[model samples]
Target chain A: MTTIAPAVSGRRRTKSLGSLEMGRPGFAWAIPATLFFGLFAIVPLILVAVLSFTRWDGLSSPELVGFENWSALLDDPIMIKSLWLSLLLTVLGVVIQTPLSVLLGVWAAGHQRNRAILSAIYFIPLLLSATAVSVLWRALLDPNFGIPAQASWLFGNGNLFGKQATAIGVLAFVSTWQFTPFHTLIYQGAARAIPRVLYQAAEIDGASTVRQFWSITLPQLRNSMITSMILMVVGGLTTFDTVLILTQGGPGTDTMISAYYMYEKGFRNFEFGAASAIALVLVVVATLVSLVVVRASGYDKMRSTLEGM
Target chain B: MKTRFTRTVTGTAVLALGLSLSACGSSDSGGTGASPAGEESGQFHVLVYGDATNKVEKQIVDTFNKTSKVKAVLDTIPGADYQQKLQTIINTDQAPDVFFNWGGGSIAPFVRANLLLPLDDYIAKDPGLKSNFLPSVFNSASVNGKAYGVPMRGTQPVMLFNNKKVLADAGVTPPTTWDELIAAVQKLKAKGVTPIALGGGDQWPTLMWFEYAYDRIAGPELFQKALDGDKQAWAGEDSKKALTMLKQLIDTGAFGDKFDSVKFTDQGSPTLLANGKAGFELMGSWEYATIQDFNLKFAKNDLGYTNFPSIAGGKGDPNNVVGNTNNFYSVLKKTKTPKAVGEFLKLMYSDEFVKASLAIGNLPTTTNTEKFLDAADNPDYLKYQFNLVKQAPSFQLSWDQAYPPSGIEPIHRAVQQFFSGQIDADGFIQAMQALPAA
Candidate 1:
């Protein structure tokens, strides 16, 4: 017993020494990465943060202006409207795309014969760049010589969803088309991970297909749905390229997203201070939203549930 | 995971290497000092706006290099994006030693920022330069009595028509008066021919029409007053009359049904006049090269040039011309040797450079270069020069080039809106007034 105890303590000491060695290797890999991130990402972000509190015309050195840029943001109607529009797009994208992707994914998974073909078809949009998609959709949604116009003409035309709604609808549709494939892949993997025994047991107990899907399939896919939802929310919040190329925040700034408005302010008007302030606000809002979504969706609980299943 | 790590390392190494190499190259190029022999040896970078493949620009640059000590490097950017590129370079303190600059408000921002060096002292010491360049050409380059650039060429707006076709179809000669021009347009339209082909699709071309039309109606005095911030109402009766006349021309379908859709450079509209597709085109002297490229033939008498038709009740003279000097070169304030740059400018304005520019159908701004305009060599060139000097009361600068940057864009947009029927006379005037005055 005495010999075994000494040996056990020696093994424990060796294990602790091995952990210290592992920690050194981890830090060796981390130092370069940290340096890189500091140079490119952290430095630029800190610079932008500093510039947000200063008045800089992008020429000459910036002058510190305290909270003037932040105060000005309250009175800027265009920026406020753009912020609201961005939030609306983010909410709508998540609400509409997340369920559609899961349903499509589940249905595609059941059709084993054409699974590859259907997946390829669904993934076609993901191949296209945002600018290319924007151009293609811009042509498709143009008021003149566009697919929508021709369709409306056959049905008799009068302001489809009233001009403002038409723009929002088009933006949402394009965003969905671009993002659904990514979510669908996630959901398909989740669906495949569901144990076949659960379905078999439900079938033996006289549970119908719909009931089996609700009880077995959905419960299993909860973790993936949460993951896809988070991705969708974050992606939608930063939507800029498609909207920039398609509408340029036009029709009287009705389609201006926060990112697009910031670009216009910074590059077009040389209002870097104001743009940086807006960017800081966007970062804060995005962080708060992610936290709220992660907590409310019970992401950790779902992850544990999936593991237990 | 291993592949991703390798890829990230490769990307970082490449980015750092590329940035360091570019920094080294720029510093090396910039560090070359001026030679003591009044010759630039290493490189003299010139930033120009246009297609680099342009024959005329190539010939001028080639001739200048062969005759001078400087090895010229031409950087050509498209005209639409040139200002943005130039502004970025200037802001970064990486301005080219010699760069092309448009005459008026286009150069004002650079001048105001103290980015451009004043060339007045250079011009003052050179008697040959003072004698060779036209007074008005020098005037165009001067801002607040200080010269910022050298005038390369001058352009004047003129009426171009298919001599045989237009005159024969109308059953009359080219119109010399406002009434006659209207009658001629009516005659041409009756026969299903477009009288004038103005590409309203491009906003700048549409703005040119307004400038020409307004200059003919209001003359230089009142127009200068308006441009000079006199605060006189531009929506007065005279301005309304001009707008109404412009609208009347539009109503008569003088520009034809598809004028708005026609791309300015393509579809052979400019070439169409040379090819006899239409009656007349109101264009600047720059069209001569294009006309020559199409191999069009015009007798000295057949080719007609005139000012925009004057309004019967307007105060402006019919002979008044809307024109300005073209893009000119200016030396940077940070140049290591200003004398070498001045010498290079002198070489560019020499007789040989003038001849090369004139041979390409460009109007030489130099007074001594009139030798190239001899009737025996080019009768059309000589006649145009004679007509310009005699007829034009004063060469009014293109409004786009003359106004401050902030003021210029709004006027351009206002004119475009006016031509598109988005706004009427009073509304257009109000929009113009709404722009911040200099």
Candidate 2:
């Protein structure tokens, strides 16, 4: 009995009560949450997945066609084009918005005078709904009486950048304008959380202001940067409302995103099976990219490191 | 711990309760269910595509509700989104008992799906209906000899609506021929006035120009033959001439430089004529109602409607007009109380409905509707409609609604591209020729 008590006590010494107790309430809370998520998100996703394997035109009973819809998506040229466009937009949006947002956040954070006013001004577009933004940009980009055309005329460039490039640029620019503010707020919060001493330490090491930003400020904002980039990628990939309202995937499908194409296929053409397949492909790609982003940012490593400290 | 558990349980219960309530609400309101009591008890739910604020549709609906045995409930969706919404409802089997539908290609999908109740039986039983409607209008609703809808109005292609004051100021009467029209437009152009009010922003209106020009050059037979897949070239010599003439008008700034930015339904085109900024507008008979809605006034004689004049030495006839049966009403196949729907249809085609419709400048499809056409006694302007229908040798459906969806939407896009100069005359012809033959 004495030998067994010593062995059990030795095991108990290594396993802390705190570690076991920490997640008990979480498990208790997770039951209803899991039920809710199962009912809404998981169940709907499964239904869509099952539907993707079927040959149904939204009106009739769905018949399982195995991998036919997936194969059809692989062969569809328009679907391929739309996928490429969505990817390009997502990459461009993230590439442009991240650094711009970080810079804006850093600038806005350091400046005390009129900080609130500047923040509000920067956030106005974020406050406007997507529909309103589309309408406003439509007027601003109108070839006849628009500000862009007027500027082009004043400067003697036949167009702002020529017709095709002009439309693409406008779409990318509007997307960035609408989303950058959200990222700015995220980065600003992250940047504000970093102790002032880190920048001071960088300065003491003979680093310039830009060097300090690259080293201290940016590195500290790693998690937020990853978060913002993921959001931007997902948002850009799923963009429909702005494109539908503004261009309707037109001036010749130059700005047709995957989401817009799905909407057209599902609603306009009533090819729900094809749309579901496209949606599944989008989800898989987004999920894989999100995993890579989270891993690369070393979020798991950071949490462990913090725990160790 | 007990309090936390109680709070969690209560929250879950509330959420569950909410979900159940919402589910109930959606099932009752959104899903396919029995018609409302009013609809079951001889009331008709009439869904229309037009301006809800327009007194014309309201007056007709109100009169029908008051005077007829069937009560009317009118739900007006905006013209642009109406078709899409109607299609969704029809597909879901939540369609209203009676709803407005465009007569030709637009209704073909519903007809083919068996979503609409064929009116052949109803028409046969009610002999008066067979005689009441014009042959052309009746034919528009018939597909392979079975009627699926009842044409309620008449439609025509863009005609020249001249602003008498603007033309007089430019020292010109309404042009009688294409050359005279061009000369008048040129005269108006020289005076720094817009020659024509063109709403190119709405791609359909822009396409109407192409259709009308083609009809005027190639005639209806060749055009129908082209749609029927008998012709290999849309850019035939006649089509080329039409495109050249259209391009000439475009170059002459006949449509204002900024016409692409204007919305079609905002009266941007008609405003040019009404405000005396333009001499003529290429529009349909429906423009009379639009003009009246906008509070634009002109003497009945001053507002002249003329066909797009013949191309000089063209193979087509000068007097031929592009026409179709206008919006029609269809009963749902799933209606439990079809008698109520039939009664509503009766009221819709009744004498009072015809008179009210005509009073608002809409030409009724009913034969002898001309008797109710009081253009002289009333402020309504339907003289052009009466003249066009009476004088036409044959009427062709509007290109947008003339063929099946597979054939129609692509043509609309092609016409817009043609107008936008993306495709040349030959290219336009080749592209249209490639459409699957009807």
TM-score of chain B of 1: 0.80
Task: Please provide, for model 2 over B366-431, each residue's C-alpha lDDT reduced to its tens digit, 9 standing for 90 to 100.
Answer: 766777775434434466566676566656677767775455545755765665566777777776
**Among all candidates shown, the one with the greatest lDDT:** 2
What would the per-residue lDDT of candidate 2 be over residues A166-217, giving only the tens digit for each residue? 5566678888889899999998887776666556667778999888887778
lDDT of each: 0.65, 0.67
Q: Indicate the residue-level lDDT of A255 in model 1.
A: 73
Q: What is each candidate's DockQ, to 2 decimals? A: 0.06, 0.10
RMSD per candidate (Å) reads 9.5, 8.3
TM-score of chain A of each: 0.86, 0.84
Report the Cα lDDT for residue B149, model 2: 77
Write down the TM-score of every candidate: 0.67, 0.79
Relative to the true structure, candidate 1 has a C-alpha RMSD (angstroms) of 9.5
Residue-wise lDDT of candidate 1 within A230-256, one digit each (tens)? 777667777878776655564335677
